[model samples]
Target: MHPTTTLLPLPAEAPPSLTQILDEVTTVLCHILPSSLSVKSFSTRWQVLRSKLATLKSSISEVSDSLHWSESPLLQTLLPNILSTLHRVQTLCDQCSDPTFNPGKLLMQSDLDMATGWLSNQIHDLDLLLRSGVLRQTNAIVLSQPVPGSGKEDLGFFIKDLFTRLQIGGIEFKKKAMESLLQLLSDDEKSANLVAKEGNVGYLVQLLDLNSHPSLREQAVSAVSILASASDQSRKFVFEEGGLGPLLRTIESGSTGLKEKAAMAVEAITTDPDNAWAISAYGGVPILIELCRSGSTTAQSRAVGAITNVSKVEDIRTALVEEGAIPVLVQLLNSGTASTQEKAANCISILASSGEFFRALITQQDKGLQRLLQLLHESSSSDTLEHVLRAIYSLSASESISRVLSSSTTFIIRISEIIKQGSIISQHISASLLSNLSISDGNKRAVSGCMGSLVKLMESAKPDGIQEVAANALVSMLAVRSSRKELVRDEKSVMRLIQMLDPKNELVSKKFPVAVVSAVMAGGSQGCRKRLVAAGAYGVLQRLTEMEVAGAKKALQRLSGNRLKSILSRTWRA
Candidate 1:
């Protein structure tokens, strides 16, 4: 049998003598105090001392209550003094553990000397009383057994002992051992690392198995949650030890508290990509979706967070959508907290990225587009807006959705405003959305009203992709007769299009500009043609005609009869 599982024999039913009790108290105090000289050890030393003191106080009370006080006056008198000394020592330990206490300054040699001297006086008085036969001697109370080993070695032994008890001990013993291990894992990252490195993580994982006691399984779930949350390395260790299978099982069938903690553990573990696939294989996606839909607030948040992480991969994202994650995430977006709303938006973004089928699924949900637009309007966070815009961009890929969004004056204005003022990514997405919306004639005219902003975006020194999208939006708008007239009326707009005809520009950069010029010349309005010519369109087109670029040849062919062209031809010949 494991030593930790071996319950020590209980003491006989007799009141202890004063001398024996004092000796027992002294031994407890000795273990509580630090033997090392470093002041850094003070906090740990105080914690151990405080725990031992509680057990000693309980034992002393038990012995005192059993005595016949009137028949033992000396014992009674000395008991009060001894108890008083214990109380003082307990108070001192409490102060040392207080957050505000600076160990570096408070743990001076002089302070230690004073405290030890006082304790010695109390012990000496108790001994003198014993010699005078004023207090009877009884068997010493063995309050508790001291853990074997010291310092770092002690932590290793303590973990091994707990594991042994967990394996072979009774229900009550297992509970106590599990609780002890849980407390150590909860203390800090260092403690959790110690537990993981000691090969106890696998044992803890075993406790979570189906065959383990329900209560032990619950405690084990809670411990795994702590270890997984304490550090990334510890979380990886739990996953490697096969934590995901039991954790998902608990989420599916455990009690409410266990389910909540198990969900949290699964969430932490799923941060690793391999574990995410394992969770999905264990059929965790459907369970997570249910948790998001109906679990407690904490469970719902963690469930959604896990789904968000899991949905990052393509195959899993398709599975999540098929399980109807889109509508549930849309519901969460409308009613959940800001954080939940953000995560839901991210999941939706990923799902929507899968393809047009998933995009249509999200768009077809009741108030799905409305909720996403509302979130876009209400959110001040850049990340949330970025995801919302990405989803919008995907949804806009469907011409039906694009036409719906394009027809809404409010939606068009909001997207145009984002292009004008949002973050760089937001600007890029908004531009892409506008480009998609511009595919429809009515949407073209609607976006054409914001021509100045589009022009500025194209002119800014952002990446070619952003500028290309903006240019495409402008070119699409130019296809509408009214928008074409608007472009020709603004000389700077006309001049910008003319400048884009520069031969050195990339083929992509030149495509829209060529299309815009061709559209204007095709309008055949003499006044618009004269405005383009005045905006230096003649020189740009003459050069393009020489190079025989696609749309430039067609545009130059149409300008053949201009009397103004003759004057420009003489200047070009020079």
Candidate 2:
């Protein structure tokens, strides 16, 4: 009996090794090339198919050496399908090589086209496997084994493993991987550094593709948002990978939650000016404007923040203004939550600072000034108040806005209260604004009511700049005779102006104080000039005159002439 030739089936529990599968694939390709070459009519089609198979084979060989082929989840998932495709090619090749096989030409052509497409897909799969950083598994393995006495577990392995899933896993797997990755990034900035170091930020950017599932894109954007917000290095990498274009698309088309995360990412990445301009070039301003106009509060806040950052670029600020962002921002100032209102206020301030055109736009917006003033009354956060004050201050720089502001007596009184009671920074801005407003001849009387507040601010403000601003504002107000008379009537206010002229009193500008005193002397009664001279104005003006401070020489001459006249009058009376 021929040694009993009963063939035993291989164990179902054990799959073929990677090396065995690769060998089988190579053998099948070798058979396909010779067999395909023999079919004369379809030789060109066969050549194309064979070339694709050969490329797939080469990709597999290249990655197999660097990757631990046995342990690779990529190969484990892809190899079975890859091997099944090779078998189909092998059967197709055999049919083409068979002399007796007579499948119609159309059938043969279809078979060849199908085989070529299959090989192309397999090649792409292999490409993804190699790009997935499967070779980095060596680092993961070494990192997985704990070092002696190192209490902290290294997450190198976990991060790399997640990247592999993002790069090569199916949609469900990628979604899960992104969720875990975001959680990891949210929990520790170290993971973001690792992800950046691993050069896998592009993987997250890839998931932002418009063709990606909405849930996956949202998760991916969330991950990117965390990474960008956490590290500048990762943010640079994200921008390099063209993250802004996709992020803008997400803002325009994605769901509210996705748009919010994308806007946050855009805001964080755009901290760099290059990224800011890049966003504008990609037409991000209008999308962000629309989001601020219609998105949820969180989305509106983030979009406004992004606009704020982008508008730091001069041209981009022009673009934002042209896109009608000012009115939308003004609308938010009235309707958004406090945080949103603050963001809107800040963006408007930035726009206002950019140019006179933006300031005019802000002023021209419906109820823009009204909404900002309302915020000052309603917002309890110092940050919000600061931003609103800054926006108003910026608007106040425009002559038209200044005239409008000066016309409102209620506005003038409220500003006086703010100068007295607001934060020091708010006080400083308010004082500066008051100075600007006082320049308008028509505004002088309306703003003159704030003179007491300005005098108190000059004496009590901490920063020298604030005091200087108040003194300067007092000088502007003094341009009106009514303001000078009020100052002379309040002897203490005249005394404060005298104190400011002292060279030793360095907190206020000498020119401003000199101007204030000159106006007060010129407008006051002779008794008022006598009181000023008694209050030490003569010595302060004399020193300032020697120091060559502007307006000082004339001021001292004025005071001396007044004193000489007063002495002559006394003699004449005696």
Best by the lDDT measure:
2
Off by over 4 Å in 1: 1-195, 209-219, 229-232, 255-257, 312-322, 439-464, 478-574
Q: Give the alpha carbon lDDT tens digit for every residue of 1-574 in model 1.
A: 7566767899889876665665666564564444322224455544444444444445444444543322433344555565556656655555554667665655543454455555555444433333222122231111122243335655655565566455544577678878888777665457777778864688789888888887888889999999887788889899999888888888888877988899888888888787788767888899999999888878888899899989876678878877888889999987987778888998888888778888888988999999999999898888889889988877777888877887787787787778777887888788788777645676566657567667666755666587778777766666778887887787666667776777765534555666667766665667777787777777777888788777777776665546567789999999
lDDT of 1 at 413: 75
lDDT of each: 0.71, 0.77
Give the root-mean-square deviation of each candidate in angstroms: 18.8, 6.0
How many residue pairs collide in each prediction? 1, 0
Q: Which ten residues in a row have the lowest lDDT in candidate 2?
A: 141-150
Candidate 2 residue-pair clash tally: 0
Local accuracy of candidate 2 as per-residue lDDT tens digits, 1-574: 6798889998688767777887777777677666677766687887798788778868767866774656665566677777898888788777877889999999889888987887787788677556655554655422132343323334655666677677667777677777777776766666677777764788789889889887887788888888788788888888888888988898988887888888889989988887788876788888988998888889888888888888788877778777888788899897998888898898888888777877877877788889988888888888988899888888888887777777776676667667777888887887887776744555676657667767777766476687778877777777777666666778767777777778998767677777777766675457657777888888888888889999999888777886688799999999
